[model samples]
Target: MTWNWDQPDWPKFSYKSEALVPLEQQFLLQSGEFVGACKHMGADDQETLKIELISEEAVKTSEIEGKLLNRDSVQSSLRHQLGLGAERPGIDPAERGISEMMVDLYRNFGDSLDDATMFTWHRMLLSGDREIGAIGGYRTHAEPMQVVSGPDYKRSVHFEAPPASRMNDEMTRFIAWFNDTSPGGKTPLPPLTRAGIAHLYFVCIHPFEDGNGRIGRALAEKSLAQNLNRPSLIALAYTIERKRKDYYAALERNNKELEITAWLTYFASTILEAQRNTIARVDFFVAKAKFYETFRDQLNGRQEKVIARMFKEGIDGFKGGLSADNYITIGKTSRATATRDLQDLVEKGALTRTGELRHTRYHLSLAIQSTA
Candidate 1:
């Protein structure tokens, strides 16, 4: 017999609870850290802080964007969360993989991403593996569902299975309810808060055999962008990855309990923590730009143009970092010329290239002092 989690029907999750105190404290501490990082630092050019900000910026954007999927992207996402560097994949496939999917989904619907889109994103995350789900095109599965804690590790926990042949119907109903019931399903809860809940709920549904976790997170991002009314931003997969074990436990707690008060509260709090971090990252870049601008008179024409493009596009253009193509476009020069200009900037400490060849992307080099 299966050992199910506790499900108490006594109290419905609302506003008040001593359970939320720890969450509040946790969020408060995170908010303070965010403020400290963004607010006036003694050293105007805090290179270490700036790098942390850069990595964070990338991580948050990816998370919000719902673009991260796969081992490399997952690792990169975790790396960003852990504040660790080195020992990583060459590139973040999530950005390249999921950003377009998200942007297009928002554009088509004219307001928020729909449930179908969420399922499609799930399919995409699984790279169109038909066996993953029946009707494999965003429709929920047509058969009994299976759960797995780990792919290779068969000994891992498997649970939260939905009844046979009803996964699709029940989930469809839930999606409809979620979209229509809210005062502003897209905006009722804060984006990060909403993200936490969505992630948990989708996982609870357990619609697919493989890629459920990744897809559930993706759905969280799509809803999050809609909720925040900012579809262009990246996902906070990094934040989730940082607290992987905690995140899993939170989910476990959420699934076990019938009432969502504690689950929602904790989820909302983590989201707030993630939110503070993301906003602070934006502030950090603005601060970095301002500090770097003090020596603006030293910059040449092309350098100025690159900076202008950067200012115009903000970080999404290359906040996770810019690409050789982005440099080519931003510099408005030929490939060879763009290459040279990028090289010049690299030497001048304006940019740093990560990965090799076509995988190359140039990002603000926070480490090196900018040359006039």
Candidate 2:
């Protein structure tokens, strides 16, 4: 049985233009909303949001490939790249490499995609790793490239990419199509939709021996950023990581077909979901700002620290709200002082008290509930 790449019309992908109309419309609207939200944020808040989003993207993208990275290390690397000042002592080379690659994509979103650019991205992706035999270039051998599952004796091959001999021509066509923006040359597809197609196409090519998936995702993000004419505003990797099973299923199901409507549809839906999540995060930040503004003058040192932690940690920051014991631990205060601080917050309307005595808990009274 031949794979899709072996078919006569192998690289020709088709989808009904009308089918994507709704998704395109929704994506534009949501993108506008997310951008608008970013504009309203104070500079500090905006910087914080950007760092958090990129950090999450870097970590989650790796997670999808079954590689776990330290979130702090990733965040620290990103912070250093963005000149935000790193709080951590040292960064792992792998973490630094991933951050550099992601930041490069974001920083150069408007530049045309080319082979040299892709080579640099691949190199950055595998910078610290000595285990992978090949890095910073295309696969040299024509070894059978199949994504399979189960034991060696009972494995199921989900997909097989074209032979390595085809990589140069295949990539040339893709890069040309990606960089083409002329109206008469080729009708430009919607940016978000184009990003989805780019992702599927690159992954199907499977040009690299390692990190094809990560590179494909990075390309998608770069395409989206170019389309929006801004830095990446949302982390699509987070949404993809959450629905990874469905994500792979979509790719596998579409691998054998000439018409990629199903894959495109799935991809569009994922973007919409990602946009909604981004909007929700923006709302939380806005609400947090408002909450702080409303009580900025009323908060004491310990109260300020605790409230900041609540916002930073979100739900996991404090389970069941802040108890007296929780406050003592977080605030580093004596029992009497913690009790007084909680009472003061309640009286000042900064927090609401529930339960009684040992069971009493203090919850932030701010109208905004964090989505974190």
lDDT of 2 by residue, 1-372 (tens): 576677789777888868889998988888887877788888889888787788878988999999889888998889889888864777777788789988898788888789988899888888888877778878878688889999999999999998888888989888887777322226566866688788998999999998999999998888888777777667699889989999999999888876888888899889888887777777777777788888878888888888887777642346777788878888999999988888898888878988887788888776543242
How would you encode candidate 1's per-residue C-alpha lDDT over 1-372 as one tens digit per residue?
231222333112233445556664554465455555445554544444433433443444344434343434543444444345543555444442343344344344334445566656654445534454443343344554544556675646545565546566746765764564233754364444445556666666666565566566556656655543443233255566656678767766656555566666767665665655465454646556663765467666777788666754433445656776776676677888777777877777776678888778777654322111
Of candidate 2, the 10-residue stretch with the lowest lDDT total is 180-189
Best by TM-score: 2
**Over 4 Å off in model 2, which ranges?**
86-88, 181-185, 297-306, 314-372
Which segments of model 1 are wrong by more than 4 Å? 1-96, 105-115, 128-135, 138-158, 184-195, 224-235, 295-372
Q: What overall lDDT goes with each candidate model?
A: 0.53, 0.82
Count clashing residue pairs per candidate: 14, 0
